[model samples]
Every structure is written in C-alpha cells, then in structure tokens.
Target: MFARVAQEDFSQQALYDELCAHDQRSRAGAIVTFTGRVRDYNHAGAIDGIELEYYPGMTEQALAQLIDKAVKRFSLTNAGIVHRVGRLANHEQIVWVGTCAAHRQDAFLAASFLMDMLKQSVPIWKKEWVGEQAHWVAAKGSDDDAAMRWLTEDKDS
Candidate 1:
C-alpha cells in the first residue's frame, strides 16, 4: 500500500502500528521501516522551513512503479510508502517506507531501494525557506550516484 499526504503533521506511532497491522497476516519473518525527517540546515544556508510540490497523478504513478520494482527485485512480501507534501517545519516527518520479507536481507534491501528510488525518480520538488527568502532546491548529483549504485550493481557484488 502507498499513501501521500499534503498535511502538516503525521503520527510516527500510528504509522508504525498501521504497517505492522497490515503485515501481520503475512508469512514474512522480517520487516524494515524507514522514516525521514526535515532538518534545519541545508548546504546553501539555514532553512527555517520547506514547502514540497509534486505533480499529483504523475508522482504517485512513478512512486508506485518504483515500489513494484523494489518488491520484485528484493522478493518482498509487502511494502508501504508514505510521503508528505506541503509546508513542513524542521524535524517534521517527510517520508516513510516499510518493507516485509521472509529474510532480513531482502527486507533491508527493499527498504533501501525504496528510499533511493524515491529520491531519484519521484517528481517531488522542494523549496527551502531560509530566513526571509525562498529558493528551489536542486537535485544533487550525489543522490543520482546513490540511486545508481542499486541500478548498476547486484547486491552480492
């Protein structure tokens, strides 16, 4: 399952509980969860806050395809991703991913894959509000390199 919200807040405990509840009936032995939070600092300057914008239908479709790829590549039993949009304050939750698999390795790999792919392929754009100015954040080459690691190499290698 996948969900995206344009709200101002989310509950970490609630999300964790929901992920576990949804995967309880599965025969998987391992589950991995990842949560990303907004920090106060960026390379350019100190960010007071951030506003995320996404192309509604296209963004969701791309993310779903990414998740499907991760599931197929890592042999995951279940996977869930939630990304929050709109204005976000420092220390606020930005994204979450949960993966379940019969083995720990697959679960871990799937979780990593989801994050990396989301960073690279998702159509979400962030505008950082620093002091009294706002600037559009550009995608870093480092992120492309990180995502390429998974796309170009096999895990065992």
Candidate 2:
C-alpha cells in the first residue's frame, strides 16, 4: 500500500513489518520480499558506486501504479516498493519489493512480477561509476522479456 522513490536507503525488515501490520494481515498466509543490491562489478568489470536519478513526482506515481497492478492481479493483502536514488556504494541496497498474499504461490509470483515491471518501465536512471569513468547503464532486453512473461501469464490466469 506504500510506494516510495527516494534518495535514502530502506530497511528490508521494516518493509516486511509494514506488510505484516496491514489490517488484512489475518487473512494473509504468505509474505514474499525481493531486495536488489548494488554489486562491485557489472559488464564493465569493477565499479565504485552508482548515482540514481528520477523525476520526483512521476517516479513515485509510476511505482504506485505498478504496486497497485500487482495487488489486484494477485489478490494481495498488501504490497510496498521502495527504490533508492542518489549515490549508493557497492553492496548497498538499491531496491525492495514486498508482497503479501493468501498463498505462497501468489506472494512469490507477485514479487517477481513487480520487480520485472519496475526494471522494465520505471524511469529511474542509473550512472555507474566504474573506476575513474562513469557510464549510464543501458536497459537490458532480458528485463523486457521477463516483464513480458508476466503480461502473457496475466491473461492466462
């Protein structure tokens, strides 16, 4: 029920607890979470950190829409997404997705779907600081493919 695109880091556990405190918690049997972290290396070999940027209002709206879609599609009790912007060191958390559902299958599937959609559609840009040089990261076709899988599965379900 919460979506935030901010410059500060988030606590995965806090996100979990927020879902657990949902009014419909008694009806939820499964809570699934996905945390994306910055690694030391990408295609460029090694990196020091990444600088993320996004238009404040638009980014938050887009994320809320993604979470809303997941909630309705999966019959989720609650859901939340938090993505970090600004400079972040390697190994720091970059994104988090959490879903609460009546069953394990729904929770897992929703989490996966949200993550894929976020990567595919979100306007958040990333500039990786690789050694002394920086490069704007490009979108991967793999992310598009993964998000497409959910669209196809949505109709089937």
Candidate 3:
C-alpha cells in the first residue's frame, strides 16, 4: 500500500507503470486507477486556481487509513493514493487513486471506494479563487449521497 500527500506534481503514466509492475510481481490480475484534475470552472465561475491546505501528519494518517480500508473491504492486493496540496493551477492533476486485485470487480470497486472516502473523509481543505475573490468549498450533498451507498447493506441483497 502507498499513500502520501505531495506538494509537487505527479506523472500519471509513471505512477500507473509502477502500480502495474507491483501488481505483476504480486500476481494481481486487474488494476484500476483514477486521477482527479483541478478543473477550470466550478459553481462560482471560471476558477483561476486553487490553494489546498492540510495538517501534515494528520492528512497522511487519514489517507493511509483510507487505503487500508479499501484494500481490506475489496480484497485488493495493493493500493496507492497520492494527493497534491498547495497552490494548484487549472487543469493540473490533484489526486490519484489506484487499486490492484485478483479480479476486475474488486479493483474497480476499491478505486471507487477510495475516491468516495477521500471526498467524504479526507482532511484537506480547498480555497478556490474565482476572479477577485476566494471561497472555501463546502461539502456537497451529491458527494455525501454517493458515499452513503458504501455504508449501506450490500446492494444485491
């Protein structure tokens, strides 16, 4: 498992390659990855950029717990998550979540689980710049709704 809060940019290809290598060594048959980028627009208006902040040790610990939860819940062979903090320009990558499993379903669900949990539970805060003003984003109803699914009884039941 890998989890880290980074201040520098990350390469999706490089990270994917590393995950693939690790999965191959571990005999994982499926892998899934998600990368989130700083969008150019949001509810306010055209976003110039965003400034992210977090409590260093606390943020890392939260992420590690998230990855561990994902791996155990989905029976994943391995997982990795990298989230960028500090000032980020529009269209720059902000987060990456990857999972490896013996089956595709496990890998997909684990990746989805990690992202939903990140949105719901991560310690990072964002200050988005919209033109001349900055606004701190509030938790969204949609995100909460999405995350609630995982907390409920199994869907097929």
- Over 4 Å off, model 2: 23-26, 155-157
What are the TM-scores, per candidate, against the unseen true structure?
Answer: 0.92, 0.93, 0.93
Off by over 4 Å in 1: none
Across residues 86-154, which tens digit of lDDT does each residue of candidate 1 receive?
988898989988888899999998898889879898999999998778899888998998899998999
| lDDT measured at residue 90 in model 2 versus the true structure, 0 to 100 | 98
Largest lDDT belongs to which candidate? 3
Candidate 3 lDDT by residue in tens digits, 36-118:
99999998568899999999999999999999888888888889999999999999999999999999988998888889879
Judge candidate 3 against the unseen true structure and give its global Cα lDDT, from 0 to 1. Answer: 0.89
Which 10 successive residues of model 1 have the least lDDT summed?
A: 1-10
Which residue pairs collide in model 3, if any?
none
TM-score, candidate 3, is: 0.93
Clashes of each: 0, 0, 0
Model 2, residue 103: what's the lDDT? 91
Q: How much is 133 displaced in model 1, in angstroms? A: 0.8
